[model samples]
Target: MKKVIKIAGILFVLLLCAAYFLPAVQSYSHIPGEIYILKGSSKTIDLGLPVKADVDSSGVVNISGETLEKGALMQSPLVIKPLNYGKATIELSIFGIPVKTVRVNVTESLTVIPGGQSIGVALDTRGALVVGITGVQVSDGKVENPAREAGMLPGDVIIRANGIEIQNAKQLMKIINETQGTLALKLDRNGRTIDIFVNPVHDPSDGKMRLGVWVRDNTAGVGTLTFIIPDTRQYGGLGHAITDLDTGSVLSVREGEIYFSEVIQINKGESGIPGEIKGFFSNSSGHMGNIEKNTEFGIYGKVFDDVDLSAFGEPIQVASRDEIKTGPAQILSTVDNEGVKAFSCQILRLNDQREPEQKGIVLQITDKELLEKTGGIIQGMSGSPIIQNGKLVGAVTHVFVNDPSKGYGLYADFMLGMLD
Candidate 1:
């Protein structure tokens, strides 16, 4: 009987060891967002927006900002957009593996105002919304016009003409105060370049000149790098469409342009706080690659300069969608000290088609270096190549909002197929 008891004790000890060291109990899941994958395959991804909702019974997963339920799922479709010329994470995912973000360009009409009651639109400083303005500024007052008698300044930029662009100061001042429902002129005075906006302000006496707010022409910051496809000498970036960030509208172009940027600055990030990459947008005409487009996948353009960008010997092959094993990997981006540095990462959680967001691939970081600067993957690193098993799997797409070290990537096959 004592011998039997000893054997039972030994068995218990072995079981304990197995429980302690073996891989985790394939638990609920990884990360913060709700999960929802394509009903069939993980290859099909969704890039749409999500709204708050109560958990439903079938095909539903609930996710919060910090905590997560392992092995559980909640949502569907992934939507991405870029902000500040792509410098900030308007929407990005970078925690573990490759990163991802989408760039949407908005084109707005220019509002010109001469003077008096205004007409036209003005773009919010962020470039998101363009609304009708009623005022603007008066420059180089005409001699015979009431503007001369009204004494409008030369450097004064307009905020609203009672608001819009006009032919000359004559059309202006002559129409002041006559405005009932309309007012114009919003402007700025920068050195010699005087700018005028058409927004309205209230004026009681003879109402000579009035402006509503301040405006600027310069746009700065970083953004994602979509793709660099080649047709002999040229390469294109952004596999999909370019839309306006503020309005969430796509841009139609005669011909798109590419620029070579040197990374002079970086902003390291943390949970709930994302970092950034800074570079100069140049018009120096990079090597002329090619430009092509597809409604489903978006656009494909080429880069000109053949320098180091094209020199990488072997390209990573796109593994079968079924072959993307969730594990170790790395990405090639322009974050290194020398530029376009390669960083380490881990495959934290993956989306199976049966799960929620079947939007290609998602990963988490295990690299300390990348975690130190720019969190995992910040803005301007999108489209960086994800190399695994000596194959080029996809490009970075989004960064996890709450976690800087983790993000998302898209299958290169999907993006490349669109180009062909």
Candidate 2:
């Protein structure tokens, strides 16, 4: 009986192992992996495990066929070289168990001139954003919050005030002051349209009518340029959206412009405090581009003629996420009067993100000059190109406030995908 019990226990342990590994393998197999590459380019894809992988081409793609390393433990990546534009499927199996399938897309080579210069961005929001709600002094000494009573919250966008559409803060206030009864308010919250009514109170301090809500119409800041498609003269920058500081809501873009900015000072970053590059933008200066889309990935715009790209040299191919490796890397960023300069950094981690995000690559500043001057990645450095293995891999997006030397980056391919 004891011997029988020992055998059962062994079987139970094996069952437990299979229970965990099987689901993981099955789920990962359906996750859908995709790689985008230019024709005549070869990219190595690491499976992160030992597997026997096979490439099945749809015949639409022109290739010498897929070259894979097979062994008792196939630890190496499956190297694929696309000779022409086409599509293919890469299937992997672990000990005869199907593991995962990767979709390969080969397209025409795209070259873009990378921009690292600091540029000033001025954006007009779609409508006035309700950033905050405060108390308004009524006729007597009592103060009341009208917006709060109407169930309005921060991050809610005021689409229309009363019967007129609200374009800016001034316009919203004008309509509110002109009405005396419960003002009809139309709000947009996370894409849903909501309507509420708020009674305006007379602010005795200002001698004007008020709703006690703080609204913002426009936002301006400085950021590094990412890349420019020379053919269309279209550009992308910031590798992230321009979000409101107080409510942390991404501002809707009604209209915007990108202008050349001159970096005058650098506020060095340190632990717990992020630094910034103070740049001055004068209206007299030529506008670089007109912003068209403001997305979570970054801002997209079309460039005019006045923008300069001679300093950045020739265009470089954008590297896909699978091509990104953890090793030595450098970033092109502007620090002083020298314009955009390459600074040494180390790629520490790479996240296998399947969606658009700003934290695809983790890096640390290793250059002595950059560390001494800026302490690490500073503000206004977003959209700085991250070059690795002589290719544009990603862009600097955010800095770790606690660890000034470390920061996050967005994959260059992600930004390129957004342009279309």
lDDT of 2 at 203: 86
Which RMSD values do the candidates have, in order?
A: 17.5, 6.1
Writing each residue's lDDT as its tens digit, candidate 1 over 218-280 gives: 122333344443324322233234444543333323333344555677877677876777665
Return the top candidate by lDDT: 2
Global lDDT of each candidate: 0.43, 0.84
Task: Tell me the number of clashing residue pairs for each predicted model.
Answer: 124, 0
Q: Give stretches of model 2 more than 4 Å off.
A: 1-35, 40-88, 94-96, 308-312
Report residue 40 deviation for candidate 2 (angstroms): 4.3
Off by over 4 Å in 1: 1-241, 284-299, 305-313, 352-358
Displacement of residue 165 (Cα, Å) in model 2 is 2.4
Q: What's the distance in Å from true for residue 108, model 1?
A: 43
TM-score of each: 0.46, 0.82
